[model samples]
Target: MSDPHEQTHIDSVGSYVKILLALLVATGVTTAVARLDLGAFNTVVALSIASVKMLLVALFFMHIRHSNKLTKLVVAGGLLWLAILLLLTMTDFATRGILGVPGK
Candidate 1:
């Protein structure tokens, strides 16, 4: 049997080129959407596009698609930590009370 540790699942040049083109198109879509007046939905749209781009980069460029389960778990943990931090920051801002002058 072949060694389990041997590198496999190599991609072709065309695959890389396709991913690159997809990333470029996603970036263009993000730029165009940013110029619109979607108001509250604007953030949602931008984040969605960004998430797609991030996934493409991670799966293709970073080789996360072919990585082991342990590596995937580590990446997930990092994302969870980031989410927790953002949640705490937003909570702090949302719960803050306005300050006023003592003697106005």
Candidate 2:
């Protein structure tokens, strides 16, 4: 009988190569997107693309796809923390100009 605790997933070289190609294509797309002027949406678009690339790298290259549920939960928690920090930072930046200083 095989042990349940052992990791059975063995990814192929071809799959890794494909993921690498996809990552390269995503990078090219990011660069292309940066050239155009999209105003406020430019930041949104860039962040969206970056998030996709981050997921791909984490899921495939980092083997998170084959990880157990607990590991996935931990990753989710980390991402949530990052989101909270970014939200706070953006909020602070957005409100900075709302209250004017006496001198300026």
Candidate 3:
């Protein structure tokens, strides 16, 4: 017969409370950062916070921490693809000067 102790169980109430507290703190910090007038960097700051929150959600809420290597690889690939997309978009936007493109 299979041993109960060998299998992983879902998190209990205390564990959930801890995760919720962390999320609450992150939300508060993000809110505070939004109040600052960072001008062009505002989007950058907001995205950074969002990415951190995404990590938290993935690791905890999604229970990926206890998942296998293949799942981790899939998550990494998704993040890498998003990074590539952002890079290409930034390159295109920053290089418009070379092509004599009209004002947007």
Candidate 4:
């Protein structure tokens, strides 16, 4: 049911160009964000921008957008695992120094 050429060939030259442009834009935004002093919200903005860049890389350059079911499943599983690790790490970080001695 599927065309053979579609599976082996990259999406298109345009797609490659798009990927390049996206990378450049992400990099530019990252640089700009780094220069700004957002205080408590600086990390939040950086993470949000980085997440967008990560999504673009994952979906386009990684070819996950046109991949098979198994590939999609693997990507999903990896993301889920990463989420678990991040959740645990954040929890620990949040708890640390929460009940520590005063003026330690």
Candidate 5:
């Protein structure tokens, strides 16, 4: 039996090339989507596509997929913090007009 400490995954060059191509395609799609007016959904669609592309780059290009569980947990925690910050920012922006000025 092989030692458990040895590295199990060795990604090939072709996989990296494929990921590059996928990122390029995602960029093209983002550009195309931006050209068409989709009302408020435009932002949703664009962010969704961007999120997918970011995940691909983070998982494959950054070698996060091959990392240990602790590393994965740390990454997940960081993403969670980011989401919280974004949510707070959006909430503040959305509620700006609700507050009335004393002079008004």
Candidate 6:
């Protein structure tokens, strides 16, 4: 008998092709955007594009879109941990100026 817990989602080749094309287009857009002078917004735009690309890869290529609840929970937890770490790092950097130089 087959296992009931197994994943049954099967993507077609066309879907994979479509995802590939989309990733390529996003990459091209990222490259093009990098050349423009958007000042501080450049990093924001680049990271936004990158986040979209990451989601596409995760949801489609990694098959997370159809994954089980446990898998989804694990992914969510990982993202939360990453967010926490980033927040802590940013907090440290933001507070660095508050501490005067040791010798000064």
TM-score of every candidate: 0.85, 0.81, 0.74, 0.76, 0.84, 0.86
- Please report, in order, the local distance difference test score of every candidate based on alpha carbons: 0.92, 0.91, 0.84, 0.86, 0.93, 0.95
| Best-to-worst lDDT order | 6, 5, 1, 2, 4, 3
Pairs with backbone N, CA or C atoms under 3 Å apart (clashes), candidate 5: none
Q: Is candidate 2 or candidate 4 better by TM-score?
A: 2
* Candidate 4 TM-score to native: 0.76
Candidates' RMSD to native: 3.3, 2.8, 3.9, 3.8, 2.6, 2.3
Number of clashes found in candidate 1 = 0
| Best prediction by lDDT | 6
Residue-by-residue lDDT tens digits, candidate 4, 1-104: 66874566458889789888988988898888888898988889889888898888888888788888889999899999999999999999889978977887
How many clashing pairs per prediction, in order? 0, 0, 0, 0, 0, 0
In candidate 4, position 100 carries an lDDT of 79
Candidate 2 lDDT tens digits, 3-97? 77754798999999998898899899989999999999889998898888898899998899998899999999998999999999999998998
Predicted structure with the largest TM-score when compared to the true one? 6
Lowest lDDT sum, 10 consecutive residues, model 2, at 1-10
| Whole-model lDDT, model 5 | 0.93
After superposition, the stretches of candidate 5 with alpha carbons farther than 4 Å from their true spots are 1-8, 99-104
Candidate 4 lDDT: 0.86
What's the best-to-worst order under TM-score?
6, 1, 5, 2, 4, 3
Name the regions of candidate 6 deviating beyond 4 angstroms: 3-7, 98-104
Count backbone overlaps in model 2: 0
Q: Which of 1 and 2 is ahead in lDDT?
A: 1
After aligning candidate 6 to the native by TM-score, how far in Å is the CA of 14 from where it should be? 1.0
lDDT of 5 at 5: 72
Q: On TM-score, who's better, 3 or 6?
A: 6
lDDT of 1 by residue, 10-47 (tens): 98999999999999999999999999999899999999
